[model samples]
Target: MTLSFELTQSVAILGGGPGGYEAALAAAQLGAEVTLVERAGVGGSAVITDVVPSKSLIATADAAVAIAEAGDLGVQLFAKGAHGKPLKPEIAINLAAVNKRLLTLARQQSDDMRAALVEAGVRIITGHGRLDSDNAVVVSTGPGGTDFDRVEADTLVVSVGASPRQLPSAMPDGERILTWTQLYDMTALPEHLIVVGSGVTGAEFAGAYMNLGATVTLVSSRERVLPGEDPDAATVLEKVFTRGGMTVLSKSRAEKVERSGDGVVVTLTDGRTVEGSHCLMAVGSTPNTRGIGLEEAGVQMDASGHIRVNRVARTSVPNIYAAGDCTTFVPLASVASMQGRTAVFHALGDVVIPLDRRRITANIFTAPEIATVGWQEKDVAEAHINGIVHKLPLAANPRAKMMGVRDGFVKLIARQGSGTVIGGVIVAPRASELIYPIAIAVERRLTVDQVSRVFAVYPSLSGSITDAARAMHHVERADED
Candidate 1:
């Protein structure tokens, strides 16, 4: 049912990304006048450049990986040789065609999102938008950005997303040196790609490109890749990387990246150099919150320029709110959308569920994807949570064995005594999908025994989750006895 308030509220959203888009739609549905001001096309960088395109590219790479894995499962492609002998068909990726397909997909999604907002009675302004005050947004629109438009509203939502961080020592030229956004422009895959960081973004692109038939070199300043991820999951990925011919330079930091003839050379902080056809700088991102008049409008921000927001996605200012990467919350597209809706609901006097970090499900899209939710095993080890850990390898799963899957496992963390499921990590193909049920368990505070009672498909990857939960339950019973 659409909310009908006596006084129609007006919502002004700056940035048409996931956060702003959702906020605008929710506000309009609640009988509010919504205006969304966007510099980029609708759906923002998440759709047009970053998330959509990257995931699509990774999907293509995953297809390539499946073809190779298919051979291991006795599914082979063969052609008649000159002497009438069977010849194994080689797996190849036309990266140019793949890039075109993914970009087209991104554009189509952006257009669809735009259509949805329009259908919801939202007024969208295409231009650079900034806070004129807490009550108004000023947009520089039309004809070389000379024309100006102003939107005044009762509530303001800021979801202005973030940009790839660029270092002066290693600047991107959009050719040899590039950011994650510039990757879709390459017609051909990089012959040798040197990824400068080993975080989620870096590991994802590195693994994707390597699967797409590129020599990958991952440079990490830390002792291992995916420094912040579950250590066991990281170990599996690093092992897979090396096994797939990727050069992992753990404990190495790139000081500067310079174009060396046709390729690029990355000089390490310790004075060693590595050369590659292209370099991807996945260092991190900075919020697009600078010069946006946020501070002037009395909205508080952190030292890094991220807008400070409460659990309900509201800023310090009564009428102003912030969401997405620009906010001080967890930087995930899913989290951003939730924050946006919560902000609108709270402002319009509707029911709101405050955002929680433990309830969020996160995934790293690699060959064998790593997905996690709630408190981790490390949290238990550090005495943050009284939890018991249980792990089950996918190799032991009936479906995994049938599919010739040898790597990856399912790990469950439960309350030490009560057996209430608190967190989980899955390292397998499409771990993103597998992690959802665990997220539900965490959110609903389901006990391991309760989860074990639910029947999963006989021969499926998700069986591992149930299997792990049952093991945890057994452990709990043993403790009680």
Candidate 2:
């Protein structure tokens, strides 16, 4: 039961993302001398570029949507100088202000992380850390410098996160052709935006730009947008996007992206071209595995370049572990944190729990925020499970109507034989928050009746979840009759 490692030896963590930093903190708490190395600033891409900045941009767009819908509450609008003329609604989003706030927030996060690590007595080194051997790491400091530092460690945790994958034909110019990481640098809003992928990142940016007063065209190679998410939820999102003046081109593949005189052109595989003021490449991400000495140290990686690691985050090498997007696990901040913590416990020979992917909850942060947990309907149908799926639309919920939310629904999947809830999906504003209760239910194997007994506040959006549970109970009773 002892979680402490020998004080004589030290632990080294590579990359300063959520995974690596969490592991460093845990190791330090367990009385292990820890050294964390990062080539980029602390907090990594999640805090500086991807998650924090995108969510902040979304918050701005949400505020605009709220202001535009104020007339539904019987609020009157009048011009300042005119006698009775109604004022024309305008949403002016200053990109400079937004970018300034983004940088400020990112710096704050970095400072807080550094302070925490320092408080825990963990040494922070700003350098590129690569494994020289199973127990040795070489650090290269200050990009384009000759100085290097090498250190030996008892245990190693690799959490070097993923980077945006770019196609050979579509190199980013940082002005016209941009990646998600570079979008915050835009000072002027694009008049017409062409988004070249339909995954979570693509869909989110497309929806956000469309809401922020830009004409968006979402090009998807698959038959539907957000192919990795629930089919029903994706369908709802596609419908909402289309209704909001977004031109979604499904089953279309972009062969190459090139810059026109003043704009950009995306040539499709089917001999069609789409033009826009700017193009965003959201194809996917690749793990930062190459040139890090993973192969030299005998650490295994998958075909897609993701490091192969066990449930407890151990790699092929006994003392080496990998976590976060670099490992072959669900690429999420929450899962990454858990994987990092698990690696420390397993390495220290403490109480370690293997990762359970089924218990994990994920969300696509679109306008309505699609969130899900546990089994999916497609998996249940493929397995031929006798389960009932119940859906309750937000249209029927009073709280949604009051809040001016017209789209989205809550769906519950339960075993027909036992009426035990096994999976759930929520597509609503703040659906990420709403899905956690259902996630807890599914993880605990709670029955539909048990979920129904929990009182949801009247005139609250979560009431739809309870209503879905009741509907499932009604259907079960009807089947028996």
Candidate 3:
């Protein structure tokens, strides 16, 4: 990548998210006067309310699970184990204190990022920003939102992000019926939690709550949870959920959520009713694209209202670019940052490569997290180039056996003739941490043999990664015979 080019133009970014701040820094580094306008403090929903908060909640749940399963490992502080009789210990969770810590950590991260941007000579404005006419931006501040502001820019980047989707039939009262972001406001664990829509967010919160001693019910409209993920991996996760005593109502769609006394009742399309102490609506998210004056500025948006952008993050209108969940692309914080940086490079006339979405690594933070990178098995043209799909279960790994872990595996997708690694999937505890090497292989266009030859630590879960790659190579060699 070029260090810098003729990128001396004025750049203005809207939203203080990963994409917006990253773009500001990149533009500033390229000798441009950069300014970032944000309504929230910094870090966007990813830090303030959504991603970081949920992950922190999951961490607490994981700790609870570790202690609950301590007996199975022959390490017990109590007389409860499979070696003896399973003891039922009443577990208590302080959700208020938990949420407080989560928010604290989130704010601290935002503050740290703010310090870095200020040090980088990027001007920060605390306000809601909107596009004005002809390469101009208007930022409004103050409690009344009447605070005046004007910004002149040679280029603009919009990364306003998205919010939780709300349904008319199932409106959230922020009490019994809640959105994902409102989960942190609880002071106690819900007795019977009904998670509607078993997507990644719904599944994660459902599993975490179940681990924390709550009786959980997951309502899914799809045939299985994580309908967008690999079917095999989704099956493994669904099995795990069932084994954990979660009531999975598959093919059930929520029609309405109503309050009954202090509890909530969810009505399904097929005349089924589910009652729970609290209802979590994880239907998906709507982009925060309304009232941003984007249409007036002539920036094109998709039918779903997400800004349309090219691989380099350029929008239909010249001098304007879009990134993050607000755009018509896959949403991830890492992808947003890369798109932002790419937009700055393109705007500044610097030599830069367009973002390759196929190389994007995605981690779904479930108990046994699902992580994948590059092209999938379905993506390979088997007729054109022979593709091999090799999977190695973690049960065969020494580490998994030692830890009494089961129900996850590593899968590799490769072209048998060329041995070129394309995609991989890891379905195990901490799979999120294991998908990097596969991503690197895809990025560098490494062969299966090359990945297999790399050394992974002995008696480790990661050994499955290289070992699976090696297994693919063996199959390829066998096909040659």
What lDDT score belongs to each candidate, Candidate 1 first? 0.94, 0.89, 0.89
**Model 2 lowest lDDT segment of ten:** 472-481
TM-score of candidate 1 against the unseen true structure: 0.98
lDDT of each residue in 1-481, candidate 2, tens digit only: 3354345557899999999989998888877888999888777888788888888888777777777778888765555557766676566878779778877888798889989999999988888889999998889986685778887889999999999999998988999999999998888889899999999999999999998889999999999999988998999999989988999999999999999988999999999999999999999999999999999999989999999988999999999999899999999988888998999988876788899887899999898999999878887878867678888899999999988888899999998768888889999999999999999998888888788889999989999988899877754442321
* True-vs-predicted CA distance for residue 415, candidate 1, Å: 0.6
Pull out the clashing pairs in model 2: none
Best by TM-score: 1
Show the lowest summed lDDT stretch of 10 residues, model 1.
Answer: 472-481
Positional deviation of 454 in candidate 3, in angstroms? Answer: 0.8
lDDT of 3 at 269: 97
lDDT of 3 at 221: 97
Q: What is the TM-score of each candidate against the true structure?
A: 0.98, 0.95, 0.95
lDDT preference between candidates 1 and 3, better one: 1
